[model samples]
Target: MALKATVLKARLNISDMDRGYYQEHAFSLAQHPSETPNRIMVRLLAFMLNASETLTFSKGLSDEGEPELAERDLTGDITLWVAFGQPDEKWLRKASAQAKAVRLYTYGGRTVPLWLAQNKAALARLPELEIWEFSEEDLDALTGWFERSMTFQCSITEGVLYLNNDDESLTITPIRIKDRS
Candidate 1:
């Protein structure tokens, strides 16, 4: 028998001073068997960073065509597509064409910089795409606060993120690799 995805529930209170956006979101995420806790936390972090009434998690790892998270308008037009980790130039090209905005969160300690350097020219062509890179240590620390049923109080100020529960807390400042306007 194939392994089933684990459903986890989370309630997040987000305060993003940088964007002046504040909202509460309830999420039900299906954790794939092969997905690590760190990656799962990254998904949650991505959601918190872009919390919106229309934002939602997609089929995630199970769907190749869909982004990990997306925000859509009432007419079902995709406004934003959020992807995790490194994606190839082809995928980035497709996403930029389909959505109004596309954002990628790249993680991995030393490998992330090298990957960016190698793909810089190709990535720069997509003016509507944005890329942010997080360190492995920050992700590891964020994963420590993960739980099946959890509540998080998240704050973002001056481009720095702070997430915490009752027992643990994490602070991360993501590096912006590409910002095309």
Candidate 2:
């Protein structure tokens, strides 16, 4: 029998000063058997960063054709596509063509720099792409706050992010590697 995805519930109170947005969102995330806690947390973080009523988590890790998170219009057009980790140029090209905007959140210590160097030129050519990298230390720190049922207050100001639970807090500043308008 196949292992089922674990369902985790969370409540996020977000205050994004940079975008002048404030809202509280409840999420039910399904963690795949093969996924690590760190990756799961990163996906949550990505969702927080681009939180919108229309944004929804896709069949991540299980579906290669869909993004980790996507924002769609009422007409079912993909407005925004959000991906995590290192994706190849072909995937970037395909996502850019399909969505109105695409954002990639990459994390991993030394490997990220090398990956960026290799794909920078091709990624730069995509007019609808934006790339952000989270530092390994920060990513690891965020993982510590995960729980099956949890609550968090996420604040973003001037591109700096802070995720706070009652017991602990983690700050992350995602580096913008590429922005094509």
**Per-prediction TM-score to the true structure, in the order listed:** 0.94, 0.94
> Candidate 1: worst 10 consecutive residues by lDDT?
59-68
* Global lDDT scores for all candidate models: 0.87, 0.88
User: What would the per-residue lDDT of candidate 1 be over residues 1-181, giving only the tens digit for each residue?
Assistant: 9999999999999999989999888878999999888888888888888888889898658787788799999899889999888889889999999899999988978888888888888998998899988788888888778789889999999988898888877898888888967
Span of 10 residues, lowest total lDDT, candidate 2: 59-68
> What is the model-wide C-alpha lDDT for candidate 2?
0.88
Off by over 4 Å in 1: none
lDDT of 2 by residue, 1-181 (tens): 9999999898999999988889999978899889788888888889889988888997546786887799999999899999888888899899999999999998888999899889877887899999888888998888888788879999999898888999887889989888867
Model 2, stretches more than 4 Å misplaced? none
Candidate 2 residue pairs that clash: none
TM-score of 1: 0.94
